[model samples]
Target chain A: MQKEENKIQAVIQINDLKKSFGTNEVLRNFNLQLNEGENIVVLGKSGSGKSVLIKCIIGLIKPDSGSIKVFGEEVTDLSHDNLDKMRVKVGFLFQSNALYDSMTVRENLEFPLRRHWVQKGKENVNDLIIEALKNVGLAETIDMMPSELSGGMRKRIALARTLILKPKIILYDEPTSGLDPITGKEISRLMLDIQKKYNTSSIIISHDMNCVKITANRIILLIDGTCYASGTYDELKKSSDSKIKQFFD
Target chain B: MKSTILKDFLSETGDLTRFTMSFFREAFRPRYEFSEFLKQCYVIGNKTLPLVGITGFIMGLVITIQSHPSLKAFGAESWLPSVVSVSLVREIIPVITALICAGKIGSSIGAELGSMKVTEQIDAMEVSGTNPFKYLVVTRVFAATLILPILVVLSDAISLYGAYLGINLKQVVSFDLFTNQIFEKLTFSDVLPSIIKSYFFGFCIGIIGCFKGFYTINGTQGVGRSANSAVVTATFVVFIIDLMAAQIADIFQIT
Candidate 1:
């Protein structure tokens, strides 16, 4: 039992994280852990600090207090240069897809690689771009502007941009929020495929149950800025507790 | 209520000081974004030249036409070019050109960055291991700072040509005579102080534009507010700087 437990490693660990804006407390005593090759869905309603939680992990928002240790390094303690170095290993997909309007899909993908100084030979960079686009099934969109693409395509291109670095961990903020049912499912499927292929750990913030079922290995209910309950889909669904059962409803 | 307004004003001033300090810090840091800076320079300088040129030409023509009668009434019709050139080069053209750019470039940078902010593009850049402030704000502010003086100089040249045309319209004053008369009366002090003040105008416009946009919040409405405020604030700052420059130039002359 001890040997089996030792084999399972946590890639991200958070303890007692707190963040507030003005008089409103967004996150209070939030605690979570994402293990190796596991997908944890942080399910919550709007303005419940789901997005804030992920942003804190990426060091975009400094938590008011507490620790977020990623790969055994304290995120809050890391310098700007060190934090940027840490970001190379972690990918974040914004809720808006956040594609640069002035850049083509190819330029958008190249931006991260160029800034991170990951630029090698032209062919090598091109090959990586093509591969990343292929993964998202949008290889033909290499030269297209983001404004020309549909919402679903833009999201895929955004995911491709995130994947270009081949990060060890990905933080997805509402990946399926604005999509149609079919497109949402497709995105969920792509998330599963990327996880399986890269063997990457992820913390996905979502309210979409279908996406949760399709991608999450475990579900953590974030109620009132804290992790209220955590379990698998079936286990949480069968819970008698009203707060946990509300999610199933 | 008065205290609250005062507190808000002080807070805004404090924030702007910090933002300006951050610009200096990031500007000298390694990994200078040379390509982006060049691109901003092209955008700010090249794109603004036509508008500046048209305004300057019209201004010189009107001023020369208006002043010709006054000088002629004083039995000094030959002094037309000298008077027009002195006023345009020494004061009018620089302030006008700077104000035009404050409206044009100031609003552009503000709206662009504000839209980027509200849409999460800036945050996206941050998470991608890129410094958005260096790529966006620093490049733009520096470009505006470096480009305005060049624009003012060009505007002065174009306005002088327009003034020459205005003189030709009423009576035949040969181009050579007009040129000689203008240069004969114009001193180094007249040209130098105007050119120097233009650099200050550019810096204030750039800083205000970037500061308004960098911290934009809310949504689409917020972007609109940022762009509008950028133009207004930059215009006001340009005038204030011009007034101060005039006062300083006066002190220098007295000493």
Candidate 2:
């Protein structure tokens, strides 16, 4: 276990969130709270509004109602410029590892840094890119393009790119999805390692029970649109609720 | 088979239209991702050069050869380079480049975003305090709008070279004399309207392609459908806009 240092406060708070697409209510009165330095897993099947909930939190899709706050600042309604600036503090590792196909891994990791850091004079960019790649265990894949990477390696590279900005809150949308079991376990372990190394609060979106057990300090299960339960792994295992039991089975 | 194909086409088109409206709405709302924009320019412009260049060259050469004998019937073969340059610069290059981009960038965007949708990357961008619409569409549209004109300038120049090479195959004309002839009869009216129309062509390609890709429906098939629709629709719009621009130019006695 990593020692708690600086011990930042609750990084994200949500209240009465709601969203709908046409007649389908994707989220109904969704709410969540995440403390800084904690690893929280959101478990739900595909289209159960798990991903939708995170998208709202990140301000990707504006909610029809309710609010989201990061570090006590309302993130949901920020203007474009302000919201873009706010995004610097939040990191997301996309499930597909959305690496820019046009760039080499070195260029990929260096991209954000070159834009904000090198362009704006934030010391040197190469060292930071190297450091980020090293952290993700992709140091040797530096010169290769995203197309050249294996599925698992691509995810690691994506994670490295997310870490380049040193965000205070990290969001993972199915970080282990579509990987082989060995690779999936590696990714879950990597997530834990990243959480400890960065000491940042994390919200991991996944339906994998093993992933939830390995990475989360607390698990929030979304059934339909609302958060059905919030508890530790041990409590979730013991619960007598049919749906919760189904999740275990 | 026909019913299935028609049903697929209609549904795909409907989704494309929906995605396009959302993009326009999102574009006006806020934050421009400038870094993403620059990266898109490099992708949409830099990487597309060789393909667009080769197409432009062949187009210019073909135009010079086919139109040469007709003008020769009137004993106007000296107008060869000038004619090809004007048509290539003012019309063919931009339209063809757009269609090419429609194929390359459009399909790439569709495939990329479709995979993201299926794979949940778009959702990840959203949850990470990022607006995927602004991150994706704005950057792409901006790239198409800004980079198309420059690429046109480059392709036009190269195509004229190819046209010159084609002309010299049957006759002798120095580069200086050909350019001098080209510029001598090339009025602002002929030059301006053509370049202006190409910009719109570029914009249409970018907008339609991004719109389709962003709104991609279903699984991988949705992505393929968007890519196809974007190219087909953009190609049609290019010709329509060209006609409108030409008629407007005619009102002023231009080419």
Proportion of native contacts kept per candidate: 0.86, 0.36
Please give the distance, in angstroms, between residue A66's alpha carbon in candidate 1 and its true position after superposition: 0.8
The Cα error of candidate 2 at residue A92, in Å, is 2.4
Candidate 1 to truth, TM: 0.97
Models 1 onward score TM values of 0.97, 0.77
Restricted to chain B, the TM-score per model reads: 0.97, 0.87
Assess the local accuracy of residue A175 in candidate 1 as a C-alpha lDDT between 0 and 100: 99
Off by over 4 Å in 1: A1-8, A116-119
- Predicted candidate 2 versus true structure: per-residue lDDT over A1-249, tens digit per residue: 132432246678888988999999988888888987899999887788877777777677788998898877797768866776777888878767877666698876765564375364644577788889899888989999888889999999999989988998888989888888889899899989988988988999987777888999999889888999999999998999998888888
Return the clash pairs for model 2, or none. A80-B31
Best by DockQ: 1
* Global lDDT scores for all candidate models: 0.93, 0.80
Docking class of 2: acceptable
